[model samples]
Target: MTKNGHRPKIVVIGGGTGLPVILKSLREKNADITAVVTVADDGGSSGIIRDYVNVVPPGDIRNVLAALSELPEIYLDIFQYRFDTSDRFFAGHAIGNLIIAALAEMKKGVFASVQELSEMMRVDGHVFPVADEPLVLNAEFSDGTFLAGEAEITAARKSIKRVWVTSNEKNEAEMPAAVPEVVEAILGADQIVLGPGSLFTSILPNLVIGNVGKALAETKAEVVYICNIMTQKGETEHFTDADHVRILNAHLGQCFVNTVLVNTAQVPEGYMDKEKYDENLVQVEHDFNGLREQHCRVISSNFLKLKNQGVFHDGNKVVEELMGLVGRPNHELRHREHS
Candidate 1:
């Protein structure tokens, strides 16, 4: 509960490994959490399943569900279990992904199916897909070349100039719009969080959806961007934290981010296992003046958690700062209070 004696409604938008870490902590804090996940994944198990089944990729959604689920650990473990390569038929697919795929077929759509499964799993809060259907992420590189699909875009590794989404279906009349529930959640949220995930893929895919972007621009929520702790090699190599914000604002056509949470703790040299976490390149360089020029409030702290030689945000510390932003006035008033 906040100072007002009410649960603060937080809508976290993004998908990938990073999103769930924050969600699990938020659940512990008892915030009203809504996870708006990206549907633009086209890699690994998700890619294979989405291709054959004609359903939205379930990998990201499966992880988010597990993060917020109230089920026993054993049950969740079973749900999350991945098949071994020896099992050729089910190889590489998590049980939860298959289950979500089945539910999608039974429920006729991903949106309704997630809600039904959320109830069954006794999820602590809402989990909404950015759109009801699969969205293909398309990108234009600085070289003026174009590519489609998240995997290919990342692999091409050219500097990303911009990204947008299109319906996966052929002959689609128009670009996909986010379902009403997603937009409503954004508009009604007390606080909205953008990332801790891939800048062009996980995070931008959700925002490129037409209605989702519109609602974000129009909503009164204090939008917060949890900047990525490290630069992704293929996606954001040599990029500063402000470059991440700049890309997001460039895509959205407005500086929708109100505050940015940056990790100040340094990762000891040679600590990260490069072979295992190959995607991560280095710590994200800070550009406070650039962030200020973008009109974003900067909150820098030791939000780092080093585990198994990987650097990530310390969820509890990040959430503490997020909760502080709740019910607070604009930056001017906040500055006055500090002064």
Candidate 2:
């Protein structure tokens, strides 16, 4: 337990770049970690693999696996390796995608494939795809022209009115069984964290799953939403901190979440060069009165950091703040009052 007391079991739900970072940081602690990642990814390497092979996109899963790997630097290079130039067999493919696909084929189930991969990576904890099926995320605009697939939904220039999931493999409207261990982790967790990733695509995709949402709503664990450092141009465009919570609560409803973690440190001016950062940082704005009425406590901290050519939550800072909330009951202690 890293010279500390018992490690808290944590179940982090999300996908994309943020989930890996979250996992990487938490793995340093004494927590039993489980990452429930989204499988709706249909961009780049993951897309190519899913289209040709008809399996759940494994890009995010691959990333999470690598992040939790004991030999991350070595295995990550191998797993993340992409073909430098388009080729016949390796065109736009990640080595990890091929590895996961091959494993899924050999093992007969995505769940088993990931379990095998997790052991191979020597990850500190567990990782599961939110659903067992190849999910096609659908977003309906206010105009009623619905867009399907994560890639297509992201390409839409307009803001989405609502988002839901459907199966890419014919008429499969339901999500695959929630990995049993994931539900167990939630029910047994001391703290559960949501995003620092794309709200709809990365974060909500997991929530749209039936049992995933139910587990999230039913778990007595203290739920924490780590607000993104900046807004994505096509996704969160101009979302405020409060808007982030509003949308998540809207999708998962009030029963699922009890607390929020936000970056109180605004990006220093000019971090957003037109040629560089997206130039859209998330501003802090909370529905104080309403949130208080609903009993959802908002936790804020200066946890932003510059990394990997984009802004992110400082790994150490995130873990420190999250660890503070670990085992701490959902009390009405004010953010300032606690400090």
Candidate 3:
């Protein structure tokens, strides 16, 4: 709620590229948002910090902060800068990663640093790492073999059979305490968005969080899933929009989703040839017919457009479609003030 007194509260779950994009779009609608990001990132700067610091992985959390940022350009640029020199140890680190690491060291916690940074960024909505504890995601194959980390699971030649969080005998799985705020947002929300990212790694990791999952299941908010435009190489090689819903249901079980949003526009053949995207590998063809077969309502529109050198939803179009799902007006009043 703000001075003028009107805005929808929204809770979005996922991480990586999709979560940030969705957050950016929703923020444009002036919705008060809380992004519950996956903490299972074990690649690049995030994995390095998780291994050394033993705190919730900060990389994905940092990305979400940047996406939600509505600040000046210089500050945004500085936050995203990555050291690319031949200095092997720091070569792949991002400026935000180091800032977060230093803050964690000074404040004695990851969430504390995130809070400070969030304030500095003047983010329109709040962001939360799915769990405060460092959670290592483990993958298990049907043959009963276990892979220890996200990287290993990705690199494994065999397709991932299933994934789960790992913990010692004495502890139980739990979301970071901040997660209840996410639930509160959902319970009060007009809409809840799931993902446009990796099914297993980005979206499901957050969904499987203890209370977060239950809150989503029970919330009266209209649940909407922004299906991925392209299937991920190792994770969802041949998935369709319907396949996305099925996988979410498979992991979270039935009734996990109510509506699925898909791109109705067809990709140009010339563009596909120019980009050399593996059409056979994982393409999102308009398949609402297939999606409806899964017992979920399907809404399709021309959501795809070229942006940032890759295809993405014309953010405005995607948000408009989503708002329509819950009977909200597609107007600038989207960012209405609250009393």
Candidate 4:
């Protein structure tokens, strides 16, 4: 707990729609949040911006800002508003994305831009880019395949063997390192949370950064992984809850997660509108025995929310579980090895 009170310093690590979903609730809880978002995105508005600006993608950062923002709805609406297809001059570009791009140029880096914007947006917490600059996500699949962008990797739809990160710039000699503040946030937090996003892409992209993974391994803070409600098509099409933890453990080089939140509520068959919400998603299955084998303190619940024919983790329900652990670390050393 901070000198201010018992409000826990929470560092959320991941990117994608799932991130903002939970963040909005955490803000209401008045927890000190530091969202360490992925920079490996190479799709849609973010990809286009990165290509032209040579900066970290801003899409995920933009959504997170909105979630943590206390600004009036109209300002957020204008910030998020995307131009219509007919408007070629600004088509498909979000106003927020452009502002972030411009901010990156004005401030000279993604780190500073996010720092400045967080204040402007009246954000309740911190937002850190996973790295100092833009990074390209690279992957090797079990079928001996290779792909470079996050979009391309997912489009290939092969079983991913592992994923890694490197600077997006040409002639870069080494893998990129996570910004120091992000690692500090991880180490300083009372609790650390991962996922509810694409396991290999949105979530793993941040962890694959050497320093970020190192910090996670060494941090005494209690680590919680909120398992995704659905398996993605090109990613974890048939992955069990245990598979998710296994991949995270495999990448980090240890089984460090202290708790695994699994959704037990079933999705009604044919309830998902596949065409509308296509990420090749299916309800995730749980291997309780396997999770126990990983020594994970499993917390299963009906974390299901059906909104617009899509399956999502109920944000309120998820937060309720997280609050139970606020300012609490290693209350029971049943899972992870006691350091």
Candidate 5:
């Protein structure tokens, strides 16, 4: 609980592998968590499912649900199980993704379906899709050329100028608006977190939703951006920590980020398995001065955890810093006592 004896309300807005890592840690904290996940994914199992099923991509949402679930490990393991290549019909698709897709079909909307599933799974907190329908992520490259679809954008291997989302439905006359629950979560949050994911594809896709961006800019909560530890090859190559913040601010036309969490611990030479984690190019260089110019408080720490020859944020350390920012210095101690 917070100093005032109420659980702090935190809204984490992003998608991809990073969001779930933080959500798993946040589940143990004395906070009311709301994960506003992106619906713009169009790759691998998600893309194939979207094309055939005509539903919002469920891969990221499936992961987030698993992270916050209170179900037994064995049940979750089964839910997360993926078919082998030998099973050609269901190959490469996780059972959880297929479940979410089925629910979307039955419920008639992704947002409502997620809520129902969250309850059945005994999720610790809320999981909201940024929009009710699938959104196609479109980008304008630095060379002034345009590309549509997340997969193609990344495959082009060109510097991205900016990105936005459009309705995947045909003849849709309006830009997609975020569900009321998502905007309410952001506006009522005690703290809001942006990203530790792909800058343009994962994070921006959600923010580019008109209402979501408006709610973020109007929210009174402190917005904290968890900067990516490594630069992504196709999206943010040769970028610094401040460059990430700069692009975010440029997209919103305001410095919405109040703080930035940066990883200072360096990966030893030849530590990362390049073949496996090929998307990551190098550690994100710091530009404290640039961050200062954006009026963001820079919190530098060894928020690094290397495992399986890959680099990632130390979830415990990141959540510790976040709890402190939310005025819960004794939260860890209290949690330990209870445990």
Candidate 6:
């Protein structure tokens, strides 16, 4: 419950771009939102920062902060600004990411720094990293080979057999567990959202944490998976809606997802600019029968939003369905309080 009163607590567990899209919508609905972000990224500016500071990559964290921040437009813009490539010193870095890195050093941990920053940004919700320590994503390819690091795994272009996270490069057995707050948030949530992000890299990196995976299986909360809008190349290249959910079950060792939100909207033939939407390899074919066979309640809709020829989930539409799934809110009381 918020200081205002009772509100639906929705814990969204995933990282990357999709997490923030839904979050931006849910914030307006006054839900007590908690985002459990993945920190397994080892590419681009995040990887650079991680190598330098030994703190969890702050790129995803920075995006989540911008999404949930109730700050002025200019401030958020400046926070998100990335320097030009020609600028050697600051090129490829988001200002918000740098701020988070500084805070991590000052507070002695990522969690405390985020907690303090959330208040400073006047965030309407809580943001928790999946693990307190840095987690390196490791994958076994379908061809019986192995790879480490998120960038390498994706670039290999082989079908992913399975993925897991560990804290140490020297010892694979040393996997970091999820912080207590992360598990507690999922266990106590009224609703939990699984994805809309990269199946292997963005989403799994978070769930591969031992306690986070276990909590999903044990939590009584309605676990709703917002299926990805488009198939991701080198990851979910030929995956179906059911395949996505199946991967989640396999990772967690149980069929934990209670509901699946899928997009029924069709993408025009060759409408997607391959250069623009590089990762979007194909439309995820619907497998309603397979979902039913897996005991999942499927709710399909035209939940599509096209921008620059890239397919994205209609965040507002999806949240409406989620809100209804959790039961009707006390609109009169909520309105009174907000007003």
Q: Report every candidate's CA lDDT.
A: 0.91, 0.77, 0.72, 0.88, 0.90, 0.86
lDDT score, candidate 2: 0.77
Off by over 4 Å in 5: 328-339
lDDT of candidate 1? Answer: 0.91
Displacement of residue 192 (Cα, Å) in model 6 is 0.3
Give me the runs in candidate 4 sitting further than 4 Å from their true place: 1-5, 327-339
- lDDT string for model 4 (183-275, tens) is 899989888999789999999999989898899998888888999888887899889999999999998888888788999999999898999
**What overall lDDT, based on C-alpha atoms, would model 3 receive against the true structure?**
0.72
The most accurate candidate by lDDT is 1
Report the lDDT of model 6 for residue 124: 82
lDDT of 2 by residue, 1-339 (tens): 333577788889899888888788888876789898888888888888888886789989988988888874866797888886658678778898899999988887788899988888888788888776688788987677888888777778667777878777665754455667767777787778997788989998888777778888777677888877777766777776667777788887654567767677766665545456653444545455544444567667788886545577787788887887784654443232221
Worst 10 residues of 1 by lDDT: 330-339
By TM-score rank, best first, the candidates go 1, 4, 5, 6, 2, 3
Clashing pairs in 3: 5-337, 5-338, 5-339, 6-337, 6-338
Model 5 per-residue lDDT tens digits across residues 215-329: 9888878788999999998899999999999999999998888888999999999999999999999999999889988878788999999999999999989998898888734
- What is the TM-score of candidate 4? 0.96
lDDT of the structure predicted as candidate 6: 0.86
Which pairs clash inside model 6? none
Error of model 6, residue 294, in angstroms = 1.1
**Model 6 over residues 1-339: C-alpha lDDT tens digits?**
343466988999888888899999999888999999998998888999999997899999999988999999998999899988889998898888899999999999899999999999988899998877788889998899999999999998899989999884467676689989999999898889987899999999988888888888787788889999888888988899999989888888877777889999898887888997798888899988878766687889999998787788888998888887776332321122110
Cα RMSD (angstroms) for every candidate in the order listed: 1.9, 3.0, 5.5, 2.2, 5.0, 5.4
Q: Which digits, one per residue and each the tens of the lDDT, describe model 1 over residues 67-168? A: 999999999999999999899999999999999999999999999999999999999999999899998999999999999999999999799999999998
lDDT of 5 at 120: 92
Clashes of 1: 0
lDDT score for residue 96 of model 2: 89
What TM-score fits each model?
0.97, 0.90, 0.86, 0.96, 0.96, 0.94
